[model samples]
Target: MTGASAGIGAAYAECLAARGFDLVLAARRTDRLEALAETLRNKFGVAVRAATADLADADQLEAFAAEIGADDTVTLLVNNAGTSTLAPVADTSVAAAQAMTDLNIRALVRLTMAVLPGMKDRDRGAIVNIGSVLGFRSLPVSTIYSATKAYVMLFTRGLIDELAGTNVSVQLVAPAATATDLWDISGVPLSALDPAIVMTVEAMVDAALAGLDAGETITMPSVEEADRLIADFDASTLALLGASQKSAPASRYLNVTA
Candidate 1:
């Protein structure tokens, strides 16, 4: 599990440990990671290793991915490490935007690639990618953050098709505004948002796990009528594909002589 230090990631570690899975938790905060590891070890009688690495740094990310790739015992990978910024494109600093992209998109992709080959070889494993509902509804303030999540959503969807015949499964989880430190870090505290829209961290993780058990490719924890939305999105994608197969550009783009 990446981002295993706090919030959703820490919650996942607890749940997975209780289910008797020895864990390898990765995050930048050594203090929190080690503490969580110790708690899980004492409470669940499961072995837990805390790995501290700043994933936004290329060297650390590559090294961590290599280590996980070589671990044949790893049966599941939860790509939960991500960062965000809530500012307009122009207002956001280039360094901040790049760091968010590196952690959210680059780290997730590298880690998933690290585990996939071993999982395919073993023919039994699962990958859970945490995305956001902002991936589907982009806002001016969520420019880079939403784009990163949209990448996760599309990446997971394509992987599902690629792994169709294989025993390995991949799930994309798009959570809305969850009650996590992410809000504070993004400069938008949970109290600033509507209480009704915020989901408890535990509830979100539980629903995501239930969706995984039910073999759902995409899980939306907050959406009550998620299936209908998914179906419509899929149908629209198919329609777009069919419409794009023409030999020339559409008449709307053509210059017609009247």
Candidate 2:
């Protein structure tokens, strides 16, 4: 589990540990990763180890990848290391944008690439990408972060399609704004969000696992009725198909040349 030191990634690590899965926790923070490993080993009687790498650094991640890529013991991959940028694009620092993009998109994709060939050879594995509700909706302040997550969602779905005849399961877990370090980084007040609607970390994870068990590629824990979201997706797909027709513009756009 990459990014297993904190937040939703930490929750996934814990859940998998409790389920008696051996783990290799990867994150930039060595101390936090080691501490989490010790706890998982003590509590769940699962073998746990820590691999610390700043995934934003190419050299570090590549070295880490060489080991993780070939290891047959790792049957599950949770590519969940991510950061956030919460500012208008005009004034957003290049560092912040690059950091988020590097961790969220580049790290996730590279790690997946590293482990996928092995999994495909074994014909058995699972990948759960931690996405966000913001992946579906557009928000002004979190444009880059949201866009990266949107990529994850689509990428996971595409993988699912590609691996349909195989035992390699790919899932996308979309959680609404849960209480995590992310908000603290963004300086967004928890009070500003609807508290009643927010799901606990456990509930979110449990629901995602349920989806995994049920062979659902997409999981939305906070959503009660499935059709609601399906309808929205269908409408968007319909719009996409309509756009492909490339018809003439409406009467309003017609040139009324004098």
Candidate 3:
């Protein structure tokens, strides 16, 4: 698990530990990571290792991925480490945007690649990628963050197809407003959002695990009618695919002048 120091990641560690899985928790905050590891070890009688690394840094990320790749016992990888910025694109600093992209996209891909070969070789493993509903529709404040999540959504969806025949399972968990420190870090406190939409971290993780048990490729914790939305989205994508196979441009574009 990445970002295992707090919020959703910490919750996942607790749940997974209770399920009798020994854990390797990774995050930047050494203090919190170690504390959580100790707690889980005592409470669940499961071994937990806390690894501290700033994932936005390329050297640290590569080293961490290499270490994880070498661990043959790792059967599940939860790519939960991510960062976000809530400023408009023009107002957001380039450094901040790049940092977000590095942690959210780059780190996730590297870590997933690290665990995949071992899982494929063992022929029994699972990968759970945490995304956001913003992936489907971007807001002004979440433009870049949403784009990264969009990549995650499609990437995991494609992985599902690639790992179809294998015993390896991949799930994409897309959550809406969650009651986590992420809101405060992004400069939007939880109090700013509607109370109705904010879910507790425990509830979100539980629902996601339930979805995984049910063999759902994409899990939306907050959406009540999730199947309908997924079906409609899939149908629309298929229709778009069918429409794009023509040899020539559409008749509407042909009549237009540059």
Candidate 4:
């Protein structure tokens, strides 16, 4: 489990430990990681180890990947480490925006890539990536963050496609703005957002697991009306199916030909 230090990641750790899975928790925060490990060990009798490393860093990431790669018992991978920035595109600092991309998109992809070879070889594994409802809906302040999550959703779906005959299953958790430290991390005061929009961490993980068990590729916890969302995504995908990429520019581009 990556991002096991706080928010959804920490909740996932607790939930999985209660179900009898040992954990190698990785995150940038050593103190919080160990603290959570201790709590899980005491409360659930699960073996927990803290892997302190900034997964956004290439060297640190490769080392952590080596650790997971070396462990044959790693049957499940939960990619929950991510950062979101709350600024309009023009106002968002370049550095902060880049950092978010590094963590949410780059690091997540690298970690998944690292685990997949072993999972494919083992023929039995599961992966759950924490996404957001914003992946489906546009939020002006969360544009870049949502784009990264959209990548996760599409990436997981593609993995599902390629791994159809394999035993490894991939699930994407698209929770609405959840009750987590993410609000603060994203520069939003928790009180400023609609309380109803927030979901508890435990409920999010539980719903995600239910979807995983049911073999769902996408799980949106707060959306009780699941069929509508599925239809929406399907319609969007169908619209794109007719898009042309290999052909030359259509007549619509003739006026701008230079």
Please list the C-alpha lDDT of all candidates, in the order they appear: 0.94, 0.86, 0.94, 0.87
Candidate 1 on 198-220: residue-level lDDT in tens?
89999999999999999999999
Tell me the TM-score of each prediction against the true structure. 0.97, 0.91, 0.97, 0.93
Off by over 4 Å in 3: 255-258
What is candidate 2's TM-score against the reference? Answer: 0.91
Sort order, TM-score high to low: 1, 3, 4, 2
lDDT of 3 at 33: 96
- Model 1: lDDT equals 0.94
Candidate 2: residue 78 Cα off by (Å)? 0.6
Q: In candidate 3, what are the lDDT values of residues 1-258, reduced to their tens digit? A: 999998999999999999999999999999999999999999999999999999999999999999999999998999998888888999889988998899989999999999999999999999999999998889989999999999899999999999999999999999999889999888788899999889999999999999999999899999989999999999999999999999999998897988
lDDT of 2 by residue, 5-89 (tens): 8888899899999899999999989999999999999999999999989999989888878889979887999988888877778
Model 3 lDDT-worst window of ten:
182-191
Model 4 Cα lDDT, one tens digit per residue, 1-258: 999999899989998999999999999999999999999999999999999989878889888887787787889999999988888889889988888888888878888888899899989999888888888766889888888888888888788889998899998888987888888888987779888778889888899988888988888988898868688878888788766654778887778957
List the candidate 4 regions with Cα displacement exceeding 4 Å: 243-258
* RMSD list, candidates in order: 1.2, 2.4, 1.1, 1.9
* Residue 258's lDDT in candidate 3: 83
TM-score result, candidate 1: 0.97
